[model samples]
Target: MNRRIRSIFWLMTICIIAINAFQGYWLWKTYQINRQQFASTVQSALFQSLEDQQVGDAKRLFIRKQKADSSSRMVIHRFDSMGSRHVRVFVNNRSDSISRIRIESEQPKRIVVTYDTQKRTTGANPLPADSIAKRISSLVLLDWTDRKRVNLAKLKAAYRSELIRRDIDATFQLDTLTSKPQNSLGNFVFYRNGDQLTTDDIIQTSPVPINPIQNLFVQATFAAPELYLLRQMGWLLGGSLLLLILTTGCFLFMLSTIMRQKKLSEVKSDFINNMTHELKTPIATVTAAVEALQNFGALNDPQRTQTYLAISQTNLQRLSDLVEKVLNLAVEEKRELVLHPEPVHLADVTNELITNHRLKATKPVIFDTSISQDAIVVVDRVHFGNALNNLIDNAIKYSRDKVTIQLSFRGNIDNWQLTVSDNGLGVPKAYQSAIFDRFFRVPTGNLHPVKGFGLGLAYVRQVVERHGGTITVQSEPGKGSEFTVHLIRRD
Candidate 1:
């Protein structure tokens, strides 16, 4: 797969695995914490119940101490043989009805109880205390020792505690304590002291039933939904980050590719331009030489032959110059061009190039030169002359009737400006920005076309830049173009 597809696949896979793992771990931790908290609450409630029972016992004992009665005694009961009993009695001096008592004992106890001036009895004669104790003992055995009844009571206590803890606001019509199934009317039976109590026996008491495990499950499930939501959100965030990175990478890659292509295009155009220039000048020189030879027999004279020979020699030299320029430009483009700078008078170089051009011109072209005799610059004479000649040739090719070539020196001794202006068709406004680009041509679509491969300005720019100078052009259509060269003057 491509890099983008592979990256996406791996990103999705990793996110899926990471999110799922994180959610699982988070949920498990929540569940464990919730379970521990629930267990803690249940234990607390059990201990609280025991404490409340102890407090109630203490309160009863204190009350009994305030009301002492000789005839009254406290009774204590123990449902299990292993349980203990305690008792205290209170007798009040001011009021007989104020008598109170407390008891703490393991076994059932009976006292001969009197209220104020009245003696209380449950049988024809006053029931013996020992007989009452025996009867209470039997009742306790029936309720507490019976396995089924003990289980039912335990279940009742546990269910009641759960309901209160859950704070269920509604009353349940069904039995709150029992594990038995209920009919539609919500009826059940319970055996207490060998007697059965039906639903009708305690219809007035309100019942609120709750399952503790179910409550825990509901709470966990409520938080459970958030797990999925968080996982999905994580996945979305991860995916978006991955997508952003991928998009940025792709954009950078495309930008790099475009820049490379543009550079290659410039190199290719430069090569084609240099190659055409290299070929055209030599071919033109050889063609001119052969044409002169064709006319040699018709003239049939030593002077004419010498003239033809000189023309051949000059054109041949032009071809040689063209070849050398191409080679130097190639080396420069590759960063291999070496400068051989020497002190040369600017006026002398200008005069030599002007003379060469005058001899080569088919039509009369005016030349103007103005410079201080002391004007000298440190530059590679050959390359500098080539650059100046390219500028002059471009001016002559585009001129209207006569070409005006002007050279002048201005600025301080350390800085010099060489201005070359021509009254020729100026560069168009639209093409001005790209005029120095290699092989860029202005399309006239005329029958008679200018002979050029469009490398002259590019060559001039390169040479000027190598000299630590800047070249700028100013022109308008149908007006003229002026090129200024700014360079450091040699001391």
Candidate 2:
């Protein structure tokens, strides 16, 4: 039975460990999924923002060289020519960087037109339509040779303005669109998730005016907000953490239970060995006495025959008591021990127990008491006396020197705390907690001085508890031991 219980305990421990491992694996998988999903969602938002009409129109209008229909009214005021004038107009069309072209018009009369983006807004001071046209023409006269920094501030501002116009809430939306599209043909990057266009580039360039300028390799980096997955997969991540906590708790609980069961199994095995040792002496004595009366001439002499008979009877009774104690423990373990609680004076009970033990002891044993006010406690008188007898018996058996016993009743508001202390080869602190557990004993080495099944403390604990009380002990290896029973007082 002990082996089977140990096997079950180990199995339970392994199962708990496996469950924790599986949960950990699942949490890691969920993290990967969340990251993939965020990438997908952010990509989808970017594509949708690019397709926005306002964003598209803003790029188109920036490069619209006088609406296509108005191209028929050519000539920025008929060029005066000393001969037939050869005049050509060009617009600065480099979209990779800001226009830094040193605009120069050549025709024997040269004029340089330059503009700064920071000092003033382009359209704040309205210029003559033709004047604006000539300035733009001079910019393109250099054939878009401006390798200037692209001021993306205005374009990013326009992108957000459009997103707002489209009723796209950035809070709930991942459209962290901070860049303006340059060449309509900039290299594209795709993401694994989101609304659509999974095969799109991470850097998407909107349709800018078709220019003959070489497209410089541009890097468009898209970054999602921090802890985006933690926020987005809110419930999944939280549930994972909760699962881990529960798993850890179960693991610890199972580990503790398995350790306790293993200890209990060892203790119970030791109990059986001790019980066998205890029963062997009495059984051997009874058998020897019986042999002396029968096989020897002892029966022929009435005195000798009576002596053998008495020895056999005494040993047989001792054997009976040992077996009875074991059976009683079994009953207690099965929770089948019924109690008949009634009003009883704890002091009277203690005195009777001490007297019985003193008479039964093989050696002269001294008894002492510090009992206060014979307090009436509610308990089963018979079983309660039996419980105290176990304590006294243990006190006598484990005594290394002069055996001494003490009994006392310390009163609490609603209970009588009965204490049974003894001066004996005391218990070690390590084994103290297990002392009251069924079949547990402090390890006694080869000396094997005391002999009995380890059920006395267990029986005491059970009976005290059945009477709505508790039992505890305090002891040190060399000093002695004390058992305290807190039984409810009816008064």
Candidate 3:
């Protein structure tokens, strides 16, 4: 409500908002990076799949070409020391041999073939190395990009397996361009290596040429790359959100605490003002009566002396009651309230209190008693008696021209229930719970019509709770109010 508190509240609000905004922005950037990494991984898998498919095709093509040539024939010369066969091949029926070949079959699934082309002569009119390299590169590119020639089902299976090995699973559309790609663009392109037989001609009759091989592009469109990226960053996002929640919670708790402290400051000032006025009037009255007797020689007349003495006694008693209320509250707050339990007659105590209040009351008062006869309960006699008295006193002080009070005592199988009802200024529903808090008073404007510190109800609650009991209030603002005390019957 004050200017300084208001400013601090707004500043805290802005700070928390800024912190959350920064966290959100960081999370967004991380998501984008993950998306890029995911795309790269998919591209790598696709490139591997194309290479795998090409290698198998080249081997099949080489075997077919060797079978179609009639002039070149293979004859096993002899068995080598490594269990491989050394074979001589006469190409175009020339005695100056083109190459010597070796074939090794070690495993059922593997066959390695090698050629010795160093002894071949330029006299056989061999094709230039550049022409052979260029032709091989073109064939490889066409085989990779030609959609019909490519075995799509096998390629897809290989691609899926590669993705799984790298921990990626997503739906995608795989297509290839028949023309050579100019750039990578959005797709991944596969290029051949001329030095390695993986893409080059299998024949070693000429020196292999190093050339810039053209690439064939494979176009893959994923259904939801972002969703996959989000899955990857799930833990990071959750942690950020949790931290934001905790930060906001702490800010709210701090704000509420500040508000409560401010309200307590105002309440304490009001209590001091009320206490000063109350003490001042009683002290002034007792002082005046004592001074009159001593200075004016009022002792000469026995009646005058007695009257002045009674006035002094009455004001002094009021002062004693006021001071006791404050001291009781202070003692309870300093430490836990201590109680000495004893068995007492509840009905008798209630009757005695009603009698005392009726005798001392100046206004017209009516008492309605609905008490069970001889109801006994175990409790701290002194503190419990005072708690009852405070309730009765409050009922009387807040009443109209004429007062009507209803006091009841009852016993169940396990507990004793006592209620005090009065035709007084009842508490509002909102303040009913707060009335039992120390130093809290209903806002009655600047001038409080009633006198005394606001320690009565708080003390009553403390005493009741110390005895292992509970208290509750039910009231309407214009009508009357009822206070109930429930205490366990300790035998």
Candidate 1: where is the Cα deviation over 4 Å? 1-324, 340-344, 368-370, 444-448, 488-491
Query: Which scores greater on lDDT, model 1 or model 2?
Result: 2
Off by over 4 Å in 2: 1-33, 36-226, 234-265, 488-491
Per-residue alpha-carbon lDDT of candidate 1 for residues 1-491, written as tens digits (9 for 90 to 100): 24554575567656666755675576557555644554344334433433334324444543354234234433332211112222222222222231222222211232222233343332122223443333333433333234231123444354346547764222222232433324667553333234443444311232212222111000101123234334535655566557656765665576567556665576576556555756676677777766876864725777777776777777788777767866765676788456687877888988888899899887678987778778888888998888899999988888787767777778654688999988788898888877787666665543224666567899888888887889998989887788999987544
| TM-score per model over all chains | 0.43, 0.62, 0.70
| Model 3 ranges off by over 4 Å | 54-157, 164-231, 290-302, 342-344, 374-378, 409-416, 487-491
* lDDT tens per residue, model 3, 296-374: 9999989999999899898899999888878866776789878998878877888889899989887888989887766
lDDT of 2 by residue, 1-491 (tens): 56776687678778877887887788778778755654454444333433332223322332455555243222221122222122222233221212222212122123333343332222232223345435455444333345333334543554456545654323332222222234678644322132323324433333222112322222223434335545756797688778878877876787688778777677777877887888899989988988888888888999998888888889889998988877766675677778888778777888888778777689778888887554677778998898888988898888875888888777754756778898788898888888887777777674457776677788788788777788888997668899888766543
Q: Candidate 2: minimum summed lDDT over ten consecutive residues — where?
A: 94-103
| RMSD, one per candidate, in order | 18.6, 13.1, 11.2
- Put the candidates in TM-score order, highest first: 3, 2, 1
